[model samples]
Target: MSQRQVVQVFEQYQKSRTQFVQTVAELATRPMNIEILQNAGVMSLLRPLLLDIVPTIQQTAALALGRLANYNDDLAEAVVKGDILPQLVYSLAEQNRFYKKAAAFVLRAVAKHSPELAQSVVDCGALDALVICLEEFDPGVKEAAAWALGYIARHNAELAQAVVDAGAVPLLVLCIQEPELSLKRIAASALSDICKHSPELAQTVVDAGAIAHLAQMILNPDAKLKRQVFSALSQIAKHSVDLAEMVVEAEIFPAVLTCLKDTDEYVQKNVATLIREIAKHTPELSQLIVNAGGVAAVVDYIGNTKGNVRLPGIMMLGYVAAHSENLAMAVVISKGVVQLAITLSEEPEDHIQAAAAWALGQIGRHTPEHAKAVAVANVLPRLLEAYLRAGATEDLQTKSKKALKNILQKCVHLPALEPLLHDAPPNILKHVVGQFSKVLPHDSKARKLFVTSGGLKKIQEIKAEPGSALIEYINTINNCYPEEIVRYYSPGYSDSLLDRVEQYIPA
Candidate 1:
């Protein structure tokens, strides 16, 4: 019971506690050790240490829990089930800066997995504490807090609104303006997650002067920072016309165009996505993109990349071309069709092909010149191939077919329409004939080629109902040539002639 004996005993307990936490922290670093740690009932072991009277012990415990929970949702759920979150949220308010960082890290690690786990963090009143941490003098603490808020907001709109209601937007905006590049990157990303859910939430971000501050870093040399900045701007611009206009007004086009060729693929993809969001709003907005030479830049990105990275670029072309004939021509003039055709042929994902097909259709639907631009790229046959493939997705089929119909109808160019004659389905065959009905009547030379190429023969064999447009189109095409020429190409004319000689001796 002496003072010396009591002091020795207290020191022994503190050293053992520190060693246990240090061991747990180290073990949590390797993915292989998580199972062992979990089976040792580590969650329970660590629960009380989270509030250990010593700050390092408490902080280390939170760090260990975060690392273990970060391994997978199962462990994250274990963290949730172990009721570790409330304590972490509680510590976020009471702890020192480093402890606050570790606490926010635990909350973020849990929230990053699923909406349900994020809800648990929110249910523990973590947002307000984390928002308070954003005001801390330490950059590390603020960075961790911003990152946690970003992850929580990323799950859904309601959770995002919860982060917003905690008064985090202005603080996050300030974080982006901070000198610490890491804080800026995460704050920018957190802003993206918050605004990506809905227009009202996006307005909150925009109202806080996020655009001008964010725009200031649009061309920041750090590729990671640029990616987040691009994403945040895209999220805001995606919501409404006025908001997109706000992004455009920030003079973001040149910097955005530069990032389209960023060394980082994510930066390239994200910036392309930003342009697509802007371009989808209206012809005026699309024109703004085209004026900045966005069409050519996006087309270049599509050409040089593969897989999902090219999707936003492909879609940007579609959105741009969809706006007006002038914009479509801008895409066409930039050789957008050529890159799009390559994606259609080379990209394996059906959705990417579908997007390419949809963009091509948008490009070719505007005028004969536009259609011819697509036609000369040898894209029509490929489009038909996509449409008719047995394995084609319904979306791919619909987009390709619509592209074919759009192009073929506007395609006054006879050569492109000729090959489709042999294989186009009856529905599409009608557009082919309709084009010939309009053009062959005006070009005697085309009528000759139609007969010699068996285009006439193919048409004669088509059995169209008398009153449908196909039949009417067939009639118009027939009237373009001599009646004998049409009869000579008729399906059974030769057989009828031979039957006249002998009924083939069969009844």
Candidate 2:
């Protein structure tokens, strides 16, 4: 088709505005086509038609601009320069209350992707107008204004600061205080942005008495609202250590702990993350989390969590475990937690199992009492079995190796297996062979596998196995372990190891 034919067809289509609206909807996801349509000059002519259609056509025009925002810079420029903003602003002021919200909503969509335009709207006293819209009895208009203010505040810190300076904080805080969960969510999110730039603004929220409201929102029947409140809690948690203290002091840990088990992984994650953040910087709060059954909760959840939740869960648990020996010991003492942790070592998720292993290792390192406890727990063999099951894949193997290495290095002395120096478990003997065969260099005294009761002797017997995986396993260990350990320690049958052992052996 010729350019004029394309233009004429488009014009004919625009004349039937319902079809035009549907056409724009169809093109909403096709940015390039939206650009082609917009740059084709059809949108410029359609703009006047859209304004004439006014409230009825505003959504379609705004949506088209949003799509055009992606590639048709000229169209974005035109929508900004044309009658759309004035019409949107006027629509908010129109006597028809329903259209007031509809117009503000369209403006929100337009401003979301076009920050310069949003800021320009703000500059033209749109901020004040939106603040006024917030006073309307209609929840929809109030919601839209909250969103628009947030988008504007996010894009223009200066504008955001100005809004706060103009007393938007108290209004937004009250939005969170509103009985409606949807409005509360939007209000909290907008407030989060405001808090990010000025953590001090949290006091403004608190002074508005949002803390108790937020704490109660955590118990909201709607899971989505609970999540929003939790997110707001986290954002505030990022501020004054005092805020986290207040949250914890409110006996809110149990509620936050309940969120750990929420079927919604996003809620679980945000709650887990907030717990971690609070526990990290505040020892008093960390102790409270510990006392409130936080450690046991995390250990239980790590066993069942998937995807993103697993990693963050592991990280938080690890941080807590590493942060305090008492916390680590608390987890270790929780009923069946060792068994739970051991079971985690068998999961398909390498990071999850690795984290479990790391936490166990840290516990073992922090308190030597766990060495025998862990050995009798039979977690080591389970980990080895998991390693063989999933360790063939590169990612899984890295996780497995790191976890195994940590457990070995941290165990320091595996007393339950000390008798193994005389009678080794077949698989433990095989593991010894594997470590020796790899010969991976070991820099630290802790990397030595020989410290386990019969671990060194077990390697010798494996080397003697005429046709065993033991031989290959030893070879692999040799390739990876420190040469001195292999050369000097492998000598039950090696002249060099005997001499070196004698020299190092104290009288």
Candidate 3:
């Protein structure tokens, strides 16, 4: 039928008119027919049906409007501009469960369009209605409501807080424990969105007992739900030490570590991220992760050909190393040091290079033994190369420089100091001098090595200036040198004249 005939029939008010509108609404849902209805201005015809006396017609019209707005931003904005948000919010309060469910579906579609449209949904008091729908007996309505809340909260913190203020936390927690797998997944997703806003809000979700539920869900072996569950746990763990400790205490690491081997790249990536967040600033926790086989898992991911998997994995290794000497040693034991060195040397991605450099620095900072291990991994050259390479951002240069300094400070190999002295830039020369001052202390063997390595000559060249920091460094080294002494030795009774000889040795 033509658009005019359809409207005319609805205007005439026959017994079957509701069915006609419902059929038209159904047709509008199909991609092939949606454009025809939209071009026909069918939204204008269906707007009144949203308030139709018959609940089924209202339900069908809302569904059609929702589907039209599903993938089309323009139509969604149109729906919002038409002031349909308030009507949808009203429908959520309807006694008819089907109408409420359809209304929620429409609201979710509209809110998902953009942040601005989502704000409109919130402004129209959709949050209150959605929270009420969460308590609905109909599983479909509850699922749609949870989804709508998740979609709205995903865009902005304010809206997320609004959802939480409307008491969505406990409801979401309950939904997660529901028998229906789909509801559980959606609720987990919603909880993830809500917690992502801030630490306080994340703690709220944890307080609502989301951690236990999410932990259980993560073990389901359902890749899709597991992804969402890990995402939620990761967000929660990010905000506070207590939350992270809680997550660890819940014994979530085993499952989280297992996910690193998941075939799905996304799952693997997110799990790596979770491990990184949890391991940060917690030395014991870092070691726990190491003991749980996370060290090898992270190393394996860093070696993956896929950048997505490798980047986060590399970053996680850095976090683990940053916490403690033992964990740093764990990284080296896993042979992660070599992988990071290779990444620093050969990875085209500057971010990966920077992260690897940072990880190496963290490892080298612990002790001379750890620093030598990083040096032995051959990262020193790559670090210097990374610093000298053109077009490297200042941040990358700083990371490379710091990593090189860490290795050099603890690395007693005097040969490594020679090239740096001759070729380093002025600033780097100063740093090298400063590092050498610490390494070359008041000892005869060290002084001899410093002299043989042309360290004295390098200092003399820089000390030529009237005022130089090198003067202090030179004085420091000179003060450590053995004083010259004249020794009179009587070789035999026949030697009348004492042979005077001067020899420099440790006093």
Candidate number of the best TM-score:
1
* Model 1, span 410-445: residue lDDT tens: 999888788998888888888888998999888989
* Each prediction's whole-model lDDT (CA): 0.91, 0.63, 0.80
Which parts of model 3 have CA positions greater than 4 angstroms off?
Answer: 1-45, 52-57, 68-74, 95-98, 415-423, 433-467, 470-507
Residue-level lDDT of model 3, residues 81-181, one tens digit each, is 88888888877886488888888988899889789988888999999999998998878889999999999999978888889999999999999888887
Per-prediction TM-score? 0.95, 0.66, 0.80
lDDT of model 3 at position 382: 73
C-alpha displacement of 70 in model 3, angstroms? Answer: 4.1
Query: Worst 10-residue stretch by lDDT in candidate 2?
Result: 435-444
> Candidate 2: lDDT of 357?
62
Candidate 3 lDDT trough over 10 residues, lowest sum: 485-494
Q: What ranking emerges by lDDT with the best candidate at the front? A: 1, 3, 2
Predicted candidate 2 versus true structure: per-residue lDDT over 244-310, tens digit per residue: 7766665677778888888888788878877876776655666787888887787677776665676
- Superposed model 2: Cα runs more than 4 Å off: 1-42, 49-96, 110-125, 153-163, 196-198, 335-365, 370-410, 415-507
Candidate order by TM-score, decreasing, is 1, 3, 2
Please give the TM-score that candidate 3 achieves against the real structure: 0.80
Q: In lDDT terms, which candidate is top?
A: 1
